[model samples]
Target: MDIGTSVITPSESAEDTLPSMFWGLDPIYGVFAKLYIKDILELKKSQPVPGVFFYKTHPITKVDILGTIVQKRERERFFSFGVDDGTGVISCLWWKKQRAMENVRLASSPFGLNVLEQLNRINQLENSNSQLELGDVVQVRGRLRDYRDQREINSTSVSKVVDPVFTAQIARMLELPYLYRNFYDKTFQIQMDSSDPNQQGEPTLSLQRKIKQFLTQNGVKNFYQQELEAIDSLVCIAEQNCVSLCLHHPSQTSQDPPSSACVSKQIHELFQQAVCALQEEGIIFQKVAAHTELYLVTDAEKELHKVTRKIVQDDSTRPKYVDKGCPFHHIVSCVRHSYSAGVSEAAVQRVLDRLECDSEIVSTMDRHYTVS
Candidate 1:
């Protein structure tokens, strides 16, 4: 499949394709969700694609979801369970191949006894403690399939969630790309403002504008506290020097200007809040060094770092091949080969996801990819 052309449609607006009613159905696939059972059921189905549902206009399939197992049932051929991730509940089914394995074991008996040992090893691995249990938080990777006209997951892999809080953090991290993509849309902007009052704060907006202005004037991609402090001082000086002709004007008051300490404190607070807001919007990022945080603008520079790190890691593990006509170049391979310090598989996957979403890469087949 030409993923760049088929799976991703960055130029088209989702609203244009969405149904008139909020509950309209659509076919969506290959997306993940971290939502409650109620929210999952509320998702609209797609008319064009039968048996497919959408969440926030994004198609979901082969999802990586985190939830707590609420119930479990084991049958002769399969085990099924219900998972509730706070929003709603969904059933997950894992089919057993024990009977097939037994047949294989019996057939292998004619061969060396070593074959039976191998069969036992496979059985041990299959019956490991990875099995689902009621009340256990778990992460599941699976396809959103249907059985008996009801939505369920045909799970591919299911593992116990080591830390519920950490799993929630991972869910939020995974959702960032989608949120960032829609952030600038007018409808999304309104939705965000309605949902979070802080998003529309006048002070925060003013601070962000000022930061942009300062960065532009300095021609720098980032600014540390020292630079921010210098700018703050200049602004205070300009404010103090302003002439007030009207007696009724607040600036005409004989009261003394704010002290340097007060000015510094206020500016510090403003800058901190502005940086946080920008980071949440995926516009900037921060690094902590020696108990101080340094802010940097994110864009091409960040992209270069991510790509370069991946290439370097791949070079160490695999032979370097020309960018074009490299059969081994694959998204999963790149992620698996990545060896950056402090980087996780989730982070590498996010980079690949973003690149694919932006049409910078195309999928040739499952796990296989090429740059566009």
Candidate 2:
């Protein structure tokens, strides 16, 4: 792979190896990390599988990347392409079956089609049957490997991007920075299974217990998944009020604080399991959708559920909404105006979902509710 320039190192010890750390890096197995090639090169491979790698706490076996094809070499069953994503160059192996091309050899365009559509189909077929060209901007998703002492990707799928406006490329650039800062860049500490039998009301000590205790002790009525303060709180509870991420950069002295941290894989697993168990037991629930990560405890908002139901029932009979029922926004507006101004669309959405689940309300159409 040709980089066209010398590789840039972030620090003096960036390339130097740290102590082999393999524990608690297994939960993220099969998660395809969207990352730059430079970060891929620096991934710590402590897991047994050759393809598995870790960046701090994220375990990655597969990755998807966007880059320009700088070089290409054809082989018998597969072809290799050198990809440059501005950070570095990495070789990607893309495999293909020759029989796919041999099976569908379209002689001419089919009947029920116009000139433009037929031409586009034929052009797509020809493109699929051809070799990749240099300077082509492409998307590659694959497992990573080391061959001849070089990091490379064994690509599972490949497609040439047809973006005239740089939309996809720009979108990728914008999205990856958030993921990098929120996930890939955060480090975490290795926690011990400390069993403290001295506590008066506590049960058997474990990671799940610790995290749950943290939420309860701190009175964290709600928290999002990516909240660093919550992550730090759990870490503090586990490690007894200490900044616990153990990433050992070369420049750090004995007194340096742990920086930009997250939980380890085991802690991450326990944390999620605890949250799910809490939700299952009705101790906590997300105020909105799961993607929002906005969790709320059982009595956090004192539950405007009954108020919302009455509002929906009363509004559904109004002259304007009698036939079509009440729109969802109207219910939200009523709940906020009457019950609480801080109520979110998602909270009202959850109330609607619960009402529907209990057969208390019927959905006439999209977001329109009526008394069941």
| Winning model by TM-score | 2
lDDT of all the models against the reference? 0.53, 0.66
The regions of model 2 sitting more than 4 angstroms off are 1-27, 47-49, 100-130, 189-372
TM-score of candidate 2 on Cα atoms, chains taken together: 0.43
Model 1: residues >4 Å from true position, as ranges? 1-36, 102-116, 162-372
In model 1, how many backbone clashes occur?
13
Q: What is the lDDT of residue 118 in candidate 1?
A: 78
What is the model-wide C-alpha lDDT for candidate 2? Answer: 0.66
lDDT of 2 by residue, 1-372 (tens): 111212223332211322235333434455678899898988777444456676765557789999999999988778899999999899999876544433444655477546565656766774584468898999988898888888899988788898997767866886687678656665533222333222211211344466556667777777765562357656555443222323232344568655444324434544555566556555566544464567775434445778888998998999988876887778989987887665666567767888889899998765779999
- Against the true structure, whose lDDT is highest? 2
What is candidate 1's lDDT per residue for 1-372, written digit by digit as tens?
Answer: 111112224344344544434322322233454444564565556556655555554554455667789989999878899888766789988887643554552454555677767767877777774476788887777777667867788888887766845645444444544543433121211112223233234555666667666665666666675566567644553233222112223343567644556545555666666666656664555443221556555442365346634553444345433332122234335534443232333334445556667776654433334555
